[model samples]
Target: MTPAPRGSVRQWLAARPVAAGYILAVGSALSYGTAQFVARIAVTRVAPPLVTTAFALLFGALFLLPLGIGHFRRARRAPGKAWLFIVLAGLTAASGVAFMYSAFSLVPLVVASPLGSVYPLVAIGLTHLFLQRLERVTPRLVAGAALVVAGVVLVVVGSA
Candidate 1:
């Protein structure tokens, strides 16, 4: 199939940032899923989790270093609260990865992976409780969240 006209893709995304965001979210999941598979194998090869985690983080940071450079100036000038939240997000990701790696060592990837997806449920519940400004809860979102939880449960139980 011939590709769309040269600038069509950019125009499409510019027209709908929300849709572009969703597309990127799914794309991240695909890359992240592949990375996790590789990390799982590496962890199994190495006995120590810290060593595995360190190597994973180092490689990831190296790969991201150039991309980070593009934002370095803006990041430096970002508000203190923004920096604080950014650090918090990084710390949260690190904690999750540490636990996930440990879990991979302790359990089957099938089990551990599905269990990890349940983090969204925790995030949703926490937001409902702690985040004062949130979008109105609609039936569509409620149903979608229910399906995600159910699907993760089925995946975990099936793997067991």
Candidate 2:
């Protein structure tokens, strides 16, 4: 089939939230795929899992330091009640990264990556339960969640 015109593609991207989300999702998946390969290589050289985990955490924190510093400075002026949420968010993020690295060391990427990819289903379920007033639980979301679960099952069985 002939590709859609460039202007039509641009218009669709501009108009559709789902389209934008899909683009970001693809980009993130590609980066994560590359990261898993790099993690595998790093683990071969570094005997300890913490060594690779520390390096990844340190560099990621360093890269985000400027934004963190700016936010801190702003918070200092008008210290908001959101500080608790911010701290929790940081902890949650750090924990996820550490666990992901630890899992990478223990399991092959084929298994670890699929396990991690199941997070979206978890998120969808949580949102449906907690934020039901904001987001209606529709058939489409249920179908997507089912597909994610099915994909995870396939990945786990195949990896085994």
Candidate 3:
């Protein structure tokens, strides 16, 4: 088959949301991993973890502000419950970042990075407990979580 046009490729991905989610998730992983590595270097050589965290979070919000501005009106119209959850998510994510940066400052990147990445296991448990109505607990998901845990263990242990 001939190659599709560039816009048609984007349309095709958008029409299949699951595939789009996978692609976006991979992109997020690559970006997050690169940021973590750079943050590790910055905290070790340039500044304290708290300073790094502040700048990183600030720049991150600034970077997204333009993209997010268009959605603010819809966000403001969302229910109070949605606002509460959104605030909680922001706080939780901020805390996670602070803790991870602190960890990177204290230990080797190999150990700290893998330990911080165990969030997927926590996500699986939380989704199983709270989001059952929205998403299913598939065998493949469980196996993937298991493999992630095993990889983290190997990384942490091997570093020691």
The candidate that achieves the highest lDDT relative to the unseen native structure: 3
For model 3, state the Cα shift of residue 17 in Å.
Answer: 1.7
Candidate 3 per-residue lDDT over residues 64-106, each given as its tens digit: 9998899999999999999999999999999999999999999
Minimal lDDT window, size 10, model 3: 1-10
| Candidate 2 clashing pairs, residues 3+ apart or interchain | none
Q: Which stretches of candidate 3 lie over 4 Å from their true place?
A: 1-12
Ranked by TM-score from best down, the candidates are 3, 1, 2
Using lDDT, rank the candidates from best to worst: 3, 1, 2
Give all TM-scores, in the order shown. 0.84, 0.74, 0.90
Q: Show model 2 residue runs off by greater than 4 Å.
A: 1-23, 67-80
Per-residue lDDT tens digits for candidate 2, residues 1-160, read 3345567766766667686788888998897889778887687666566688788778878988886785776777655567776788788877776777778888887898788877777678888889988988789888988988898899899988
Per-residue lDDT of candidate 1, residues 15-132 (tens digit): 7789789889999999879877877887788656667877788888899999779889988999999999999998888888888888888888888888887787777777777774
Q: Give the top-scoring candidate (TM-score).
A: 3
Error of 1 at 55 (Å): 1.7
